[model samples]
Target: MSAFVDTLRAEWTKFRTIRGWVIGTVAIVGVIVAFGLMPGMQGSCGKNGPGSECSLPVGPGGEEVTDTFTFLHQALTGDGEVIARVAGMTGIATGEDPDKPNHTVEPWAKAGLIIRAATDQGSSYAAVMVTGGHGVRMQYDYTHDVAGSPDGVTAAVPRWLRLTRAGDTVTAAESVDGDRWTTVGTARLRGLPPTVEVGLFATSPQHSEELHTGLMSGAMGGPTQVTGTFDHLAARDGWTGAAWHPDVIGHADGPANGAPGAEGPPAPASGVEQVGDAMRLTGSGDIAPAVSGSGGLGVSITQTLVGTFVGLILAVVVGTVFVTAEYRRGLVRTTFAASPGRLRVLAAKATVVGGVMFVTGLAAAAATVVFGQRVLRGNGVYVHSAPAGTEVRVVVGTAVLLAVAAILGLGLGALLRRGVTAVTTAVLVIVLPYLLAMTVLTGDAARWLLRVSPAAAFALQQASPEYPQVANLYTPADGYFPLAPWAGFAVLTAWAAVALAAAAVTQRRRDA
Candidate 1:
C-alpha cells in the first residue's frame, strides 16, 4: 500500500511537472464555461404571457415546457370517468401557410380525453388519445406514455375513449365497438384532487418551425387547431349534464402559436376559452418528461453541458500521453526499475490521470451548471433548473464520466503503446459514438449506439429526459438517452474496466 502511494505520488509529480498537459487540464474549466454559456446567448426568449407577463421558469424538478392544447372540460368531484367517442381526429401540418397544399396530418397528431389539475400551465394529468399514426396511447403525469391500441385513428370510424379515475389511480381503455373495450393502461397519481377537471382535448402542434425554438428548449410549437369531431360524450357520476367549457391551454407553447390578428397576448399567454357544443379547442402543448403529481418546476436546469466533448477530448489526450509518453522517452525502463511491479505503475498512472480528469470535469461541469445558469439569466435566457440534489448528481456524475473515460484512454494507450493510435481509438470508442448518437443516428439506432458504445455514459449528463409515458416526440434528436443515467454510466465503466484489465494483462506479458 505504501509502495502504491509512492507510485501515485510519482505519477502525480510527473503530471504536474508537464506544462502542456497541466495547461490543457486547467483549460477544461474554461472550455466548459464558454460552451455552457453559449446556449444562453443563442436562446431567443422573453415572450409575453397574459397581462404583460414574460416570465422565465424558476423551479426544481419540472420541465421548461410550453404545453398548449384545447380542452372541453367539466368538473368532476371525487373518482369518476371521462369518456368520449371520436368521429375523427384530423389537422393540417404545413411548413408553409395553412392555405398551402403542402399541409397534411401527422401520424402523431392527437385528439383525445384528458383529466387534469386546475392549473393550465403545469399540471399533473392523465390522457387517452388517438394519434395521427400510432393508433391509441395513454399518457399520464407528463413523461409516462403507453400504447393503448395498435389500430390507426380514422375519420370514417369512431373509437371510444374512457378514463376511469379511482382515487389516485386512473385506468384508460379504448373500444372499437364501444362495448368491447381493451384496457390501455393504468396511471397512479399520488396527490390527485377529489375535484378535478375532466375533459375532451383536441390539439395539433404546428409540427413545423413556427414554434420550434431549439432542440434543448423542448417542443415550442404553435397550436395547429385540430378540430376533432365528437358526437357521444358522457361523464360518469357527479351527474350534471352541464355543457363542457372550452379552453385552450399551453398558451406559452410559443409566440407564433398564440398571436392572433397581429395583436399579441402581451402578457404570458394563458388559456383561451370558447365554450359550446362540438367544443372546438385549439392549443399545442404537451405533458411529457412528466411533472411530479405534486407540481413545481423545482429548478429549471438546462441539460446542455456544452463543454463535454471538448473536455473529454482533452481528457483523452492527457490520459493517453500519461502512459504513451513514457514509451516515447524510453522512460518505461526507469518506471519499471523504480516500481518493479508494472501493475503498480499502471495503477498509479490510472489513479493520477483518472483523478485529475474527475476533478477537472467536476469543476467544469459544476461551474457550467451553477454559474452558467446565472449567465443565461443575465442574457434573458432563463435556464430552468432541476432539484438541488439532481443538479448535484449531474455535476458530480459528469466528473465520474470523465474520470472513467480517462482511465479507459490510459489503458488503451498502455495496451496499444502509441499515443496517436490510442487517442484516436479512445475518441472513436468514447467521443465519436456520442457525436454519432446525437447527430447522425435515428432515435432507435441512436438508442442502440448509446446502449452499446462507451459513449453511452453521456446519458449521465442529461438533465432533461423524455418519458416513455408522455406524449412528446421521444426521439434522440430531443436529448433523450436510451438508457438511464447511472445505468448508462455503468455501461461505460464496464468498458473501461475491461480495457484496464486487458492493459494490465498485456503489461505483464510483454516487454516495455
Candidate 2:
C-alpha cells in the first residue's frame, strides 16, 4: 500500500513538473470561462441595458414557470367547490405571412376550472381542464399533471370539470354527462389560505412545429390565442367576493401585481364575455413549467456552461499526453521497474490525471456557472434560475464528467501509445457525437447517438428538467437529454472502467 502511495506521489510530481501539461490543464479553465462569458449572447430582455432585467415567475416548488392565462374568477373562502362544463375550444396559429394565419387549436391549449390561492402568477393552484388534443387533465403547481379521460370536448359533447377544496387538498373530477363524475386527481397545496380564487381559465401556449430542412432542423412557432366556451358554471359553499371578474394573469404588457420585469409585449387582448348562457374566455400564453425553446423566456443555467465542450477537449488532450509522453520519452520502463506491478503504475497515472482534471474541472465549472450567469444577465439575457440542488449537481457533475473523460483519455493513451491518435479518438468518440446530435441529426437518429455514444455523459450538464406535462421541444440543442444525469455519468464511467481494464491487460501481456 505504501509503495502504491509512493507511486501515486511520483506520478503527481511528474505531472506537475511537465510545464506543457500544466499549462494545458490551466488552459482548460481559461477556455471554459472565456467561452462561457463571451459577448453577443444577449437577448431583448432588459433592453435598457446592464441594470435592466426580465424574469419569469417562480412556482411553488421554486422553479421558473409560465403562469399566464385569462381568468374569470370569484373569490372563495375556506372549503368550497367550482364546477364548469367546457362547451368548446378553438384557436389560431401564426403563418408565414402576418396577414394570413391558420385557424387551428394547438394541441395543448387549455380551458379549465381552477382553485388558486390568489390571482398572482405562480401561486399554488389545482385545475381540471380539457385540452385541444390531450383530453382532460388535472394539473397543479406547474410540474404536476395527471391525465383523465382521453377525450376532447365540443359543443355537442362538452366535458364537465370540477375542483373541490378541503383544507389543503384539492380534488379534480371529470364527467362526460355532468351527471356522473370520475375523480381525475388530487393535489395538496400546503398552506393554502382560507380565501382563494375559484375561476374558469383559458390559455394557449406558443404554437410550434418542427422545421426540417434537409439535414439541419429547427422549430418555427409563434403566439396563439385560444377561446373557450363555458356554460353551467357554478360555485358551491364558502363563496365570496364580487361577481365574476376578468383579469389577465401575467400579462405581457406589465408584470403581475406591478412586479417588475414583465415577460414580453402585450399579447392579444384576453378577456371574458357573457354570451347568452355561456361565458367565452379568450387567452394567450400558458400555465405550465417554463422550458427552453420557442416557448421559454430565454435559456437555462446549462447555457452558461456551453464552454464545457471546449474545456473537455483540453482536458482530454492533457490526459492523453500525460501517459503517451512517458512512453515516447522511454520513461515507462523506469516506471515499471520501480513499480513492478504494471497495473499499479497505470492506476497511479489514472489517479493523478483524474484528480488533477477533477479539481481543474470543478473550479472551471463552478466559475463558469456562477459568473457566467452574471454575464448573461449583464448582457440583458433572462437566464432561468435553477434550484440550488440542481445547480450543485450540474457544477459537480460537470467536474466528474471531465474527470472521467480525462481518465478515459489516459487509458486510450496507454493503449495507443500516441498522443495525437489517442486525443483524436477520444474527441471523435466523445465530442463529435454531441455536435452531430445537436446539429446534423434529427429525431431518433439524434437521440440514439446521444443515448449510446460517450456524448451521453453530457447529460450531466442538463439542469432544467424535461416534464412530460409541458409541451416543449425536448431536444439536445435545448439542453435536455434522453438519459438521467447520474445515469449518463454512469455510462461514461463504465466506458472509462472498460478502457482502463483493457489497458491493464495489454500492459501486462506486452513489454512496457
Candidate 3:
C-alpha cells in the first residue's frame, strides 16, 4: 500500500511538470469553437437573409400596381433544347437561377411562374409572347395567318384576356377557381403579329398609377401560393408547355392570394404616391414571416459539456509522457527500487492520473456546457427538451466516458513504456481510419468507418429532430442503421477494451 502511494505521488508530480500537453488541448478546443462561429457554418445560427415580400392588388382589372420587396422571376422551357429566361422590363430574356441551375427553362418554349401568391386574383402568362407593351404578356411571331371578326366584347366584369394575332391565336381562360375554365373574348384582328410581349395586368384605380414588377433572377422569390397553369400551343409547336412540366420548373399549382404572380406589378410608382399605392390593397394580415428557431440553452450546454469531456479524454497524453519521461531520464529504476512490487507502482500511477483526468473532465464539461449554451442562445439554436434528471444523466454519462478513455490511455502507456510509440499508436488507432475514409471509401463504407473512429463516440450528442440533412443520414429516414448514443459508446468502449487488454498483458510480461 505504501509503495502504491509513493507511485501515485511520483505520477502526479511528473504530469504537473509537463506544459506542452496543456497547450495542445487548449488549441484543439479553440479551433473547434472558432470553426462553429464562422459566418455560414452549417450549425451557425443567424438570420439567413431578407424574408420574401410581395405587392398587393392595385385595382379591379389590376392594371396599375405597386412595387413589392419580393424578389420574383420567371422560368420557361420545353421544345428542342433547354433554355432559361427571366421576365422583366424588356420582356422574357434568357435568365439563370443562381440557386438551382437545373430549374432553368428554354426561352419562349414553356412558361413558368417563378413565384406565386398564396391567394387568388393573379394573372398567368404563356411563353412565346414577349412584345406588347401592356397587359399580361408573351412574345411570339405567327408564321401562318388567320382572320377573326373585329367585334368581341369583353365581359363587363373585366375577366376576358384578349390576344390579337392574324392566324395563330392563344387564349388563357380563368374561372373563380382552378377547377373550372371559361374562354374570355377571342382576338379578331387583321394581319399576323410578330414576336410580342404577354403578361398579366393588375390595376389599382383607388390608389396609384405606375405598374410594379417582380424580379426572379436569384433565389426562390415571390409569394408562395400563386400558381400558374399552362396550355399547349399546337401539335408541332416549338413549346408545348408539356415536355417541361411544372414539376420540372419546381412549382406546385395552388390558389393565389391576390399577390402579383411571376414578374410582379409595374415598376414602383414615382414618389410619395407609392406609399398609398403599396397600401391601397389591404392584405389579409395573415401572412407570417419565416422564423428560424434557436436551440434551447440546455442543448448548447450539452454540446459544450460533451466537447469538454472529449477534451479531457485527449488530456491523457500528458500522463503517458509523464510515466515514460522517468524511464528516459533513468529515474524509473529508482522508482521501482523504492516501490518494489511492479503492480503497486503501476496501480499508484494509474490511480493518480486516472483520477485527475476524470475530475478535470467533469469540471471542463460543465464549464463548456454553460459557455456553449450561452453562446447558442445568442445565436438561436436550442437544446432538446428533456427532464432535469435525464439531463443530469446525460452530463454524467459523457464525463464518465471521457474518464474511461483517459484511463485506457494510462493502461496503454504502461504496456508500451516508450512515450512516442504509445502516444502515436493510440492516436493512430483512433484517427487513421477516419482519414482513410475521406478518399479510400464512400457512402456506406464511409459510414462504417465513422462508426469505428473516436469521432463516432460523439454520437451521444445527437438527439431526435435533427436538421433535415443530418437526420436523413444518421437515422432510419433512408433505411440506414442507426447507432443510438449508448450503442456508439459501446463500439468505442470495445476498442478501448482491446487497447487496455493489450496494455495489461504487455505490462505483466515486459521488464521495467
| Per-model TM-score on C-alpha atoms | 0.81, 0.93, 0.44
Q: Better model by TM-score, 2 or 3?
A: 2
Candidate 1, residues 466-489: lDDT per residue as tens digits?
543333444444445678889889
Q: Judged by lDDT against the true structure, how good is candidate 3?
A: 0.38
Q: Rate the local accuracy (lDDT) of all candidates.
A: 0.70, 0.85, 0.38
Q: How displaced is residue 450 in candidate 1, in Å?
A: 3.3
lDDT of 3 by residue, 1-512 (tens): 66566678876776666677556445435543443333321232333333222223321222222222121222222222112121221111112232442321111111221112211222222222111122323211111112222221121321122232223345333232333444433332233223322222221111111111331111122221111122221222342223221111111222111222222222222111123212111111011111111110113234444244335436557656656776677777887777777766666766766566556555545455445555554554433333455455545555555555566566667677788887786666654553444334545665687686654555554433233111012221111223566776787677766766776676567766
- Candidate 2, 174: how far from true, in Å? 0.8
Model 1 bad stretches (over 4 Å): 38-40, 47-66, 76-82, 94-104, 117-119, 165-170, 186-194, 206-223, 252-283, 290-304, 436-447, 469-478
In model 1, state the lDDT of residue 77. Answer: 79
Best by lDDT: 2
- The full ranking of all candidates by lDDT, starting with the best, is 2, 1, 3
Enumerate clash totals for all models, in the order shown.
Answer: 43, 0, 63
